[model samples]
Target: MHPLAKYAIGFVVLCFLLFLLAPFAIVPSGMRGVVTTFGKVDPVPLGEGIHLIMPLANRVVRIDVRVQKAETEGDAASRDLQQVVTKIALNYHLDPAHVSTVYQRIGEDVENRLIDPAVSEVFKSVTARYTAEELITKREEVREQISRALVARLTPYGILVDQFSITNFRFSAAFNQAIEAKVTAEQNKLKAERDLQRIQVEAEQKIASAKAEAESLRLQKQEVTAELLKLRAVENQRLAIEKWDGRLPTVSGGATPLISINPQQ
Candidate 1:
């Protein structure tokens, strides 16, 4: 009946009303609210905005259904027994329709509980199938394989794989050094082969030139010999005619020398 007591009672009622209305939850954009009644999850999920449920009996768990990125790094072995250090990144999101199931089954730590382990396991398995060289040369293939495997493994758990990538791959220092040495050796071998071919070509050209020069000289020598023989023959004929006399003369000096007797006057 007192004014103060009435005001006090009114204040208590106001507080109780506020407490009762506290069960109404606002699911923000890009999120889904999972309702659990008496620890049992409801099949239907609550979408974004205000949601009302039984006060003190139902709980709403909000889950982000937007795309998220996760990165992980681990060591794996190649098919050739080479140690490979790999880092991978993934984009994923919770399936909005399965939000309740996802929360109930795996809770809110989807990155650690599901996606991260999946990345490591899939990467190791896929890496084990390829050699270290293949892992580098066929990076796109490796990425596709990882993405496919991740989708297959995580899809059943209400996690959708949006995209996956192999960010980095590294080998041991000794192995890297060996690769460099091998490449250098191959290049040197190729250069040597080219040099040898060039030398062979040059030698052939020189031999051909020498043959040509020798042939030219031989022709010139034959021409000179024929000309000299013709000249000598002509000179011999001329001397014989000049020495012949009109009359025969006496022989002299025990030799066949012909002498002219001044025409015998």
Candidate 2:
């Protein structure tokens, strides 16, 4: 054979082998590839790494199996008919074992078709069961109800719910104003009660002080008898004599001295 012909034949064989062994899909970590043959999906899924298949007849679509987030806000009415705007966040992913089923039905746009609608439906249903005030006070209960409902609704479709959260709840301005006024009124009422108690305590203290003073005066009055007065006068006279100097007082304007003294014996 000619050298050129030999080289051409070797090249053809190499090309054929390369095409035969070409990997059609490279499923990455945290992903699963769903295989489709001639537009029909196969229930079995392809795992991570390279996969070989018939060229041009088979295709692979990768579905993420990692935890993903979805957030949406919507308006709903509570049991009391008050309008409530709710924002929620959901964490979920395709069941790794059932990625093929999920892709076949829901496709890659899980957030739009599955998550958002499910959240809206469950949120509205749960919100309808509680009043606007309950929705605020029982937020954790509402969250759990939504989360459980989501899991029940989605698990059958091969979607898994990891976590759920209610981000915000907005009410009408009038309702907000009402709530604020109510809180202020309660605070004012408490302050008024405290002031009343303090006033009562102060009045009680004044009454007790008056009673004590009256009791002391009555005791003093009872102790001061006529005999006691006479004894006190005599005691005062004796004390004055002991304190007197060894001299008699002179008359003032020919009047008698205030303390009469015949002589200091």
Candidate 3:
């Protein structure tokens, strides 16, 4: 071989060695390298250490099997025929045992086709059971029911739902206004009833006071009548003596007492 050709051949060999060694040089922590040979995945996962594979035709795909989050927002109609915007936050992780199935069916970007639709379906199905008011007031119940539904639905798809939260809810403008008006009217009715009850109590107290005063006056009038009767009797006796004429008849030791009264004398 010519001298220049020999040097070129040596450089090409060095470059091939560098490419094979470079991929295995750095394996980050918390990452596993999956080695595929001839388009077939090996059973064992490569750990955080150097690994060697064929410089040509073999490759390592890093799969991060840690827990991940999938947040989704969707709108559904409530039983009351109102539209509501709902936010869903889901905590999920890959089933390491089912990694092969996950790769086969939906691949790493499975959240879009699988998880996203599953979440939307659960929200729509669950919201159909409740009105918008119930959803707002009993949020925890809705959240628990949705979580269970999501876990059951996604489990078979190689996705494990850890937990979920129903983050926010919003209703349409017209429905919200109607609800506020209803609440306000109910409060006003309750306040009016309370005021009427208070007035009735006060009227009862005044009636009791009037009855007591009237009874006291009746007793006082009875007492004044008894004293007036005694005075009237004494006044009649004095009038009879003063009106007697100056004529007298005598009896054995007593003079006739005047029994009639003459006012002319």
Candidate 4:
């Protein structure tokens, strides 16, 4: 064997060794790596970026820490025993600080095994407390109840909840039709009340007008006394005298004309 050939073989062996054992692991952005040794998860979680690890003994499982959406639907009975179908959307992410703990207990499929069941359980529990009528009328309250319940349930498992929303609530067709018909009937009743009030106001105005006219006639009648009648007759005679020319007419007595005239003096 030559000395150069021995050096070449040593270099190839070193390269092969390096290839077989990864010197370091890369944790990408928005993810945390849970370190495990011989299938046992380490207590401490790995933050994003490169981290030193044992070549053949350590493994890194990258779990996403970014916010994610999980939408699910289920049917539950209301307090009134009405069947209600609810669709809910949950926004959550694994706690970056507890990635190792989460991985150890629940593994990678947290959304399905943990978050989904949590949502369904909390929703059904909260929904059962509200009657079907109250569910529709107090929707926000029901949603709040469900969200708070989920937060409490998942927190211990190192799942941080971002937001929860109830996307849809469906009721039976008969119940929906009943609600619509009730609303229409209430509207008709309100219209009738307003119309009756308007008619009453118009009647009051007409009665007031008639009373005012009658009062005016009574005042005119009260002023017509005997003195007023005499005064009217005297006024008419004075008007007639003002219009007459001063003259005397001859009168016939026993078929003879009697004329009386005075000479101008």
Give, for candidate 3, the lowest lDDT window spanning 10 residues.
Answer: 19-28
TM-score for each predicted model, relative to the true structure:
0.73, 0.86, 0.70, 0.85
Tens-digit lDDT string for candidate 1 (122-164): 9899999999999988999988998899899999999998888
Off by over 4 Å in 3: 1-18, 21-27, 52-57, 211-265
lDDT of 4 at 65: 94
Model 2 alpha-carbon drift over 4 Å, by segment: 1-9, 16-23, 225-231, 251-265
Tell me the tens digit of each residue's lDDT in model 4 across 162-218: 999988889999888988999999999999999999999999999999999999999
Looking at model 2, residue 156 earns an lDDT score of: 98
**Count of backbone clashes, every candidate in sequence:** 0, 0, 0, 0
lDDT of 2 at 167: 88
Q: Output the number of the TM-score-best candidate.
A: 2
Give the Cα lDDT of each candidate.
Answer: 0.91, 0.91, 0.82, 0.91
Clashing pairs in 1: none
**Global local distance difference test of model 4:** 0.91
lDDT of 3 at 99: 62
